[model samples]
Target: MTRPSPAPLRVLDLTDDLGAHAARLFVGTGADVVRLERAGTGAARSRAEELHWHAGKRVQRIADEAVLDARIAELAAGADVVLESGPTSRLRTPALREADPSVWADVVHVLVTPFGRTGPRRDWLADDVVLSAAGGMAWLGGDPGAAPEPPPRQQAEQLAGAHAAIGAWLALLARDRTGSGQLVEVSAQEAVAATLETGAIAWIHGRSVPGRTSGIYGHVAHRVFPAADGHVAGGYSGSPRMWDDLLAWMVETGEAEDLAEPQWQDGEHRWSGRPHVDEVVARFAARRSVAEIAEQGRTRALPWAEVAPPSRLVENPQLAHRDFMVEIDAPEGRLHDVGLPFESPALPRPVRLAAPADLPAGAGWAQGRAPVTTRVPRPGTPRHGGALEGVRVLDLTWVLAGPYVTKTFADHGAEIVKVESSQRKDPTRFAPGMRLRPGASYDDSGYFLNFNRGKRSLALNLRTSRGQELLRALVPHVDVVVENFSPGVLARWDLAYDQLRDLNPEVVLVSMAGVGQDGPWRSAVTFADTLAAMSGLTYETGSATRPPQGLTFGLGDMVAANAAVAAALERLHRGEGGHVDLSQLEAMAAALGPAALEAELGQTVRPRSTVMRCAGEDRWLAVGACPADELDAAVRALGAGSLADLAAASDADELAGRLQALGVPAYAVRDGHDLVEVDPQLAARGFYTPLDHPIAGPVLHEGLVEHLEATPGALRTPAPLLGQHTEELLTELLGLDPAELNTLHEEGVLQ
Candidate 1:
C-alpha cells in the first residue's frame, strides 16, 4: 500500500554550497525544498559537492527579469519561506523584488551573507577562511606563533545558514500571528563571531587579544591522558565534588604519595607547575588502559572518557542505546551516522528519517546515494504562542547552545532563574585566563558574563537535600526547566524529566545531553560541539581526503540550541507545553536533515576539495573547487595571468558575473583584508549592536535575526551579574515581603 504525502515546509534555497546544506536541513524536517538554480548553465548542477545538500530539493531554474518574476510569483504564492545567501543589494534589485512582492510581508525570507546584508562588506566576496578571519575565530586556533590559521572547513557559512533556518521559523511564527513577514538576514562573519568562546570578551574587557593555541586544551580541565589502548579526553571538572572524586581515585590508585611533595601539595602550586603536574598524571595514566581509566572514573562518579574520533563514535554504546546513531541503507550500501538532534518520544517513527533510495541510474553515478523517508505530521490539532513565556526557566545552560536557546526565551520575556553552583562555576566565567580565587569579583569569564546576561543566579548544592528541596519547590512554580547535563546524572537525583513532569503536568523539560539520554551508547559516549566531525559532516569537509578535522567553533551545540528554540516555539503554538527530550546529538542531526534523506538512499556525499591557494599573484586570491576548464579562463578574466597576477584585481563580482554569463561555476575567496576593504551592503542592513560594558567597554553585539514590523526582539539589557535582580524579582514577580526575603537569604536558600 502507498503512504500519504509528507507535510510541507516553505523553503527558498539559493545557489551555493552553504545554501545547499541549509536547504537540506528543512528537507529533512519534511519541508518541500525548492532549490533556485541559476538561469543558464546552472553551475550548481556541475558542483557534485552540492548534491549532498540538495537531496530532497526540487530544482527550479530561473534567471534574468522575466523568468525570475514568474518563478518568484509562483514561489511566493505557495512557499512559506525563502532562503537566500546572496547580497541584500541583489534582493533590492527591482527585478528580484518584483517577482515576489509578497515575500517580505507574507512569507519568511532568510538572507544569508558572509557579512550581514547591511555591513560595509555585504557585497564583498568570502570563502570559509576569509569569513572565519573576519569573525575572529582564527585568532583562537592554530600554532601560537604562526599566522592565525583558518578554521577547519565551511563552518562560518554553514553555521550562519543553520541560524538562518531558526530565524526563518521565528519570523514565520510572527507572520502566523501578525500576518506580516520580515527579512531575516544572517552574516557568516557575525554568526561565527558569536561562537569564539571567550576570545572577544578577553580583548574587549581584559585588553588582551586571544592568540592561537593549537593542540592546547580548552578552559575546562579536560585532558587527553595516555592509556594502554588509546588517549582519552578526561578529567571533567564540572564540580568540586567531581574533583574530590578524582582525587580520591588517585589516592586509591596509590598515586597520593606524589601529592605530598611541595610541588603538588597545594592547588596553586600544582596549577602553576602544570608541566610537571601533567607529567605526573600522564605517568599514572600510562600504566592503565583507556577502558580501565574510564571504567574507574565512571564507577567513581567522575566524568571521564577517552577522546574518540568519528569511526569510533559511531559504535559507542551510550550513543547506540540512545539511538544517537542510526543506520539507513543508501542506494549503494548501509551507512551509520548520527540521528536526530532532538527526539520527540511521542513521534511514531523516531529513528527513521525517510525511505531508502532506489538503485542508481548508473553504476558509479549512484555509488553513494540513498533513498529518503519523509515525515507527515499525524493529522491532529496544530498548536501555536510563547510556548515558553510565563514559564519560569532555571537555565543551567552555559556556553553556546544552552545559553543561546534560553536567551531566545529571555528575548520573549521569560523569567529564567539561573543556578550557578559555585563549586566549579561556569568555565566562561574564568576564560582568557583560568584565574579563579576565593574572593575575586573580576572572575567574569566573558563566556559566563555574556551568555548569562539577563538571568538571575542562585548558588546551591544539588547534593544537599536542602538544595534539592529548594529546586523541587521552585519546579511547581516554574513552567519549564533546561539543562545540558551528562547522561544519567539527573535520574540519580530523582529529578529527571519524568519526575518533574509528574510533579507539574505542564512543565516542559529540555535536556541538552551531549549524546542523549537513551540507547546502548548513551552513558558510554561523551562529546561537545565537535560532534559535527564524527557525524559525517566533517567527513565531507575540506578539499582533501585526510581524516576529517573538527570545526574551530561550537557549531553543533549552537545549531542544537536553535532547534530547541524551534521546538519550544512549535510547542507553544500547539498550546500544550510538556516534556521535550532534547539532545545535542539530535540537534546536530536535524541540521543535517537533508543528508539523512540522502543517507537513507544509500548515497555517499563526499567532501569538496578545499581551495588551499589559488593560481594567482596574490596568495590571498584563493579559489577552491574552481572547475578545471574554467581555471585558466577565470584567471585571465580576473586579469591574473598567473597566481602572482591574481593579486592586482580585487573585485570578483564582475568575474563571477562573467563566468555565470559563460556558464562556468565559480566563487571568489575572501579573508580579513578583503572583508575590511569591500562590501557596502551590510551597512545598509544595520546588523551590528554596539555595547558599552562597565568592565568590558566597547563591545559589539550582533543584530537580531530579523527586523520585525512590530514587537521585534531587541537586546534590552546586557548580561546580568550574580543575583543582580534577586531582590527585584522577589518583590516584583513573587511579591515576597522584605522581611520574609531576608529570612530566606539567612536560610541559605536565596543568594
Candidate 2:
C-alpha cells in the first residue's frame, strides 16, 4: 500500500510561549516551520522547553527593525501560515500586507492573545492564572469557602494554542478550496471558558451557579482515596450493574456495610447515601494497596487509578508501551517528554531540523507562486456544506472526549452516525443533576443533549452477533470510525481497527483509550479524574499547603478531544486513512509540556499563585506583573495610592474594570453565572447559542470555537434520542426491510 504524501506547507512562527503549541502542531503534521527570534533574545528559558516546542523547526535571528520588517514581508509572501501572539504591530503594517496582496491574502495569519484582538481586554497583560480567572475556570476548583484556584501550569495558554491549531487547520482546509486565507483569532480566556463542561450552560438554562467543592461536582464517591501504599483515585458508577459489581467486591473483602441494603440498589439512593458509602469504601481502600485496588478495579471493570507524580509518569507502563514519551538530545542535555498527542501510521515521525545558519534577506518575494484556486461550499446544503462535507463518521464514543471529537466534525458538516447501545449507554445520558425536562427519560439528559448535537443515532447491542454483523456492514461506508472504549473491548467484539480495515480499505479509525491500546496498564479502568491523577495533573494542581486535587472539570478529556479532531482532519486533508491511537494521558501531559521540561531539566516547577479575594462571595483576582505605565494608570483608575491599596478594595469587579480600562490585566473571578450574565465579549461573539431541543425546550449551548470565515460551523440539529433513527438508517443506508428491522428490534438486538 502506498502512503499519502505529507502536507507541503510553510509556517512562520513569531510567538512567545503563547502560540508555541500551534506551531508545534503544524510541525508535527510535516509542515516546514521556521521560528523567528530577536537577535538579543537569550536561549529558551530552559533547554527542555526549547526541545519540546521547537525541536524540528528551523530558527533565524533578525536584529535591525527595518531588516526584520522587510524579512517578515518576504517570509509572509512565501509562507502558507504565520503564527504570532500579543500585539499585531508587525502584521497590521501596510508594508507587509501591500508587499504582495495575493501572497498575503493566501497566508493564514493566526493571532493568539490573552483576549481576542478586537476585544476590550485585548491590550490587558495577563498570565495563566489571570486568564483562567477571567475565563471562569478558576471558580470551578478549590474549596467552596476558600478562594478559587487555577490549575497548575499554563493551561489557559495551552488551551488557546490548541484552539489556534484547530483554527489554522480549518483555514487550511478552506484555503484548499477558496485560495484565500483569513485571520484566525484565538483568545486564551474564551478557549479556557469553553472547557468548563456544562457549567456555563447550567447557569444559562437553570439559573443556578455551581462553586468549587471537595471533590468533582455531582460526584460524591469519585475522589482520590488513601490506599495502604499510596493514594488511588476511583469513581463508582450510577448504573446498577457496575454498582452491584462494586458492592460484590466490597463484600468479598468484608467491607460492605449499609451499601448491602436493598435501598442502596437504586443509583440515586446510593448517591444520596454517599456519606455511608464513602466511609465503607475508605475503610476498604485504606487496608488495601494501590496495586491491589488497581487489580481489583480492573477485574471488576470499575473506574480506578493510582495517583502518579511526575516521576511515576516518566516511568508509566502504559505510556511506555504506547511509546508516548520521546527522548530528545538538545544543546543542554538529553531530555524525555510527552510525544505526539496521538499516533497514526500515516503521520510523519518527529525529525531533528537545525536552524538556518544565515537569515534570508528580502529577495524571495518575486519568486513566490500565485495563491492556489479553491472554492467554498454554500451553507444549508447537504451536510451543511461546511469544510468537512461529504465525510461520513461512525461515532462509537461515549462521554466527553470521544463525543467532543465527533462533535467537531458534526459541527463542520460531516455526516455522523453515532452507534450507541442500550446495553451500555453513554454515562453522560445519566449524568447527575442535569435534566432536560421534568420526568424526562434517560435520553433527555442535559449533558447528553448538549454534547451530542447534530448526529444520527443507531443504538445496537454489539454483544449480539447480528448487531456486530450490522456494524461490520456499516464500517465499509464510513470515512472514519471513532471510539473511546477501554483497550480490548472492540477487539473482543471483533470490531477493532484491524477488522474494520479489512472491510473498508481506506477507513480511518481513531481509538481514544485512556492509556492507549497496547500498554501494560491498558486494561486499567479510568475516568476523567483518574486520568488527571495518573498523568500528574492532579498532583500539580492546588496550593502548596493543600493536597493535590484534580480539576473540577474534565480538562484531559477536552485536550484529547481537540487532538483527536486535529488528527482526523489532517488525515482527511492528506487523503490518507489509518488508525489513530490517542492516549488521553499523553494529551494532558502534552498540555503541561513546559512543566515537564522544567522537571526534566532539574528545575522546580512553579506553584499555583495565591488568590486575592474581594467583594461578592468567592470573588477574587489573579494579579501578574504589569508595565510601569499601566501600573500607574491602574492605581489612578482605582483611586488608590499604590497596588496594595487596590488589592485591599472591597469590590473586585470595579477594580478589574478600572485596571482593564487602564490596559492592565486584572479580572474578577467569574463563576458560571457571571459568564452567562455579564460576559459581554462572549455574548458579542455569539459563543453561546440558544438551541431548541424537543425535550429541553430552549437551552444555551456553546457555539463553535474555531471561527472559519468562508465555511463557518454551526449547530444544525439537537441530539438524537436512543435509536431514534433506527428505522430510517436501516431503510436508507442498509437497504434493510421494514419486517427485518422489526424482527431485530423484537429480538432485543436493536433498541
Candidate 3:
C-alpha cells in the first residue's frame, strides 16, 4: 500500500548546516523535503548533525557542480521552493549564470548566508563564533572583566534558519496573492544582531556602552538559582505585585532581612540593590529542593522552573502529559526525540516521520503535490497594495514573544493594535532587561521601545465587562489576533478561540503559552529564561569544569515568536480562522538541534567554545569548534606555548585576520562599542536604523533580519506611548463615538 504525501509544498533543499533547522521545520510542517548532496564532498554532515534534522527528508547525491546544477534544473521544474545557503550559489553568480540560464521567477529562492548576499564580508570565511562577534552577541555575554561569549554550539546558524523559514513563508504568502516568486535573503549576522535582548540599545540610543555580566541581563532579578537537587530559574521584579509576593515569601521564611527594609522595598530600586537582593534570594533558594521551590512558585503563580538538561527531558511531567516525546527505531537503535512545535486542526498531519525515501535507480524522484496539506486556499479578498499593507492585527500580548511577534507584522506594514491596562501594564515597560535611560518613565525600556516599535497602544482593562465588550466589538475589524497569556486566561476573559470564532468566523487567532494550551503544566507560570532552562539550552553552555550556563538573551522567546509569526501569516494567507496551540518550550526544544541526540549518544560536550584573550584589557578572540587539523595549524601559526603569554601579547583583530587567511575560523569578540563604532560589515549592510523617538530621543534600532527583494519591510515608527492610539483606533476601526469613548473612560473601563 502506498500512502500519498500529506503536504503539497515541494522544497529542493541545497543547504548544509547553515539552513538545516529551516529544512527540519519544513519537514514538520508536512512539506516534501528533497535534500541534494555532493557525491564527493568530505564534510557534508557530521553524524551528530544528521541525527534528527534529516530523519524524514528525501536525498540524492550528485557528482560535480555541473551535474548538481543540471539535476537542480531538472528537479526544480516541479519544485515550488529552493533553499540555498553559503555564498557560492550559482543562482546569483553573474559570471556563471551566462553559461546556464536558470533564472527562476516562479519559485521562491531563500538564501541563508553568514553576511547578506551583497555585504562587504559576504564572501568572508564564517563560523558560529565569527557571526556572534560580528553580530554583537558576543559583547553582551561573559563577565565584565572576561572575554565575551557566543551562544553555545550552532545557535547562530539555527537562528538564521528560523528567520529563513519566516521569510520563505512570508514570500509564499505574498505569492498566493500576486502569483509571483522573489528572493528572500537571510543574513545570520543580522539575525543574531537583531536578537541581542537589547544588547546594542545603550550605545544605539545613547553614548554609554553596556558591559557584560554573569548570565543575568542588566539586573540580577532573573537568573538560574542553585537548588538542593539541581538548579531552578526564577527571578522577576518587573511587576509590583510579583515583587510583593516574593518579599512576602522571604518574610514568611524569616529570610527577608534587609529586603523588608524601606530602602529595598521599592521595586524601582531592585535594579540598584542587585547584589543584596541576589544574595538574599540565593540564600533563600539554596536550601530548598527543586520540587519544593517549584510547588511554592506554583502556589504563588510565579514564573519559575528547574534548569533541566536534555537528560531530564524524558522525565518532564509536561512532556509526558502532552505525549510530546517520541521514539523512533533506526538502523542503529531506538532513539527518543520531541514532536511538532504547535498543534492545529488546520494541519491534518502536522508531523509525519518515515524512513528515508528509497527510490529505485533510474526512477524519477518527482512526486507531485499530494493532499495539499501545507497551505489552505487563498483568502477571498481584494489586494490593496503590497507588503502586508492591508492586514490588520489585534495584539493582546505583552513582554517578549507576543510583542516581538506583532513587531514582525507591524514592521512589514501591517497595522497592529497592542492592548494594555492602567492597573495591569506590560511588565516590560518596567524592568525589561537592559534599559537605556535610568529611572525614566514607562517609555524608556529599551526592550519595550525596540520590540514595540510600529505598534499602536490601546489601553483597556479586560477585567471589566464593558472592556470585554469593547474587545469583542474590535475582533471583527482585525484580520488576526494574538495573545500569550497562560493557558486558560483567555477563556476566563471570555475571549477564547471558540468565543473569538463566534465573534468573527473568518478571523485568525493564535494562543501561545509556555507549555501549551492543554497539558499538566499548562497553568505553569513561565518566563523566557524558564523556557531556555527547560529546553536543554542552558545545560550545554559554559566550560566542562564549571556549572552549566544560560544564554545571555531570550533564545526560546525568539524561536516561539517567529513560529507564531509564521503561523499567523499562514492562517491569514489561507483566509481561514483557526486556533493554533503553540508551546514555546516545544519550539525551543526543536532549536536544541543535535544536542538531545548528542546527549543520548554520549557525545555531548559542555560547548561554550574556547574564548582566548587578545591584546588590550579583556579583549579576546573566539576560536570555536575548529577541526583537529585546523586547530593544530592555528597553534603552530600563533606559537602556542602558554595561553597566559598569548593572552598578554596577541592582537585579536590582527590574529583573527591571520587565522582566517589560513582557513581557520576566528574573529574578535566584539562589544557594543565595537559593533556600533567599528564593525564595517554592519555599517555597509545598514543593519541599524537610527530613529528619533518622541520620548527616547534619537536611537539606533535593529532592522529586519532578512530581506524580501519584491517588497522589503521597513521601520515605520517608534514604540507608542500608553493609550497613544486608543481614541483614534476605536473611532476609525469600530466607529465608536467620542461620547462613548468618554463614557468608557469615565466609567474606569478604559485606561
Highest-scoring model, lDDT:
2
Estimate the lDDT of model 1.
0.54
User: Please, what are the lDDT tens digits per residue for candidate 2 over residues 443-479?
Assistant: 7776787788999999898878999889888887788
lDDT of 2: 0.74
TM-score result, candidate 1? 0.76
Q: RMSD in Å for candidate 2, one decimal? A: 3.5
Rank candidates by lDDT, best first. Answer: 2, 3, 1
Give the residue spans of candidate 3 off by over 4 A. 1-7, 40-46, 89-103, 247-264, 268-271, 344-352, 358-366, 369-386, 430-435, 605-609, 624-650
Error of 3 at 697 (Å): 3.7
Give residue 146's error in model 2 in angstroms: 1.4
For candidate 3, write residues 1-751 as lDDT tens digits: 1123234578878776677778877776667788777765425454555657777777777667776777676666566677887654333223322454454655677888878877666666677777787677777776778777677667788888888888887787667656667778888888988777656766665457667767775543688888898888888655567688888988998998888888777666866878778888998889899788887887787877777787778688887676665554566687666655665343343344654554333344456643222332224322334357667788998878888899998877678888898677676785444455666578767768888898889989898989888898988888789998878888887889899988888788888888888767777778777778877777766555667657667767878988888777656655566777778998787677766667777774544456787888778887656667777766677797644466458888877776767766667777777777777778898888877788878777888886888867888788988889999888887888989999989999878
* lDDT value, residue 163 of candidate 2: 85
TM per candidate: 0.76, 0.90, 0.90
Candidate 3 has an lDDT of: 0.73
**Native-to-model Cα distance after best TM-score fit, residue 700 in candidate 3, in Å:** 1.5
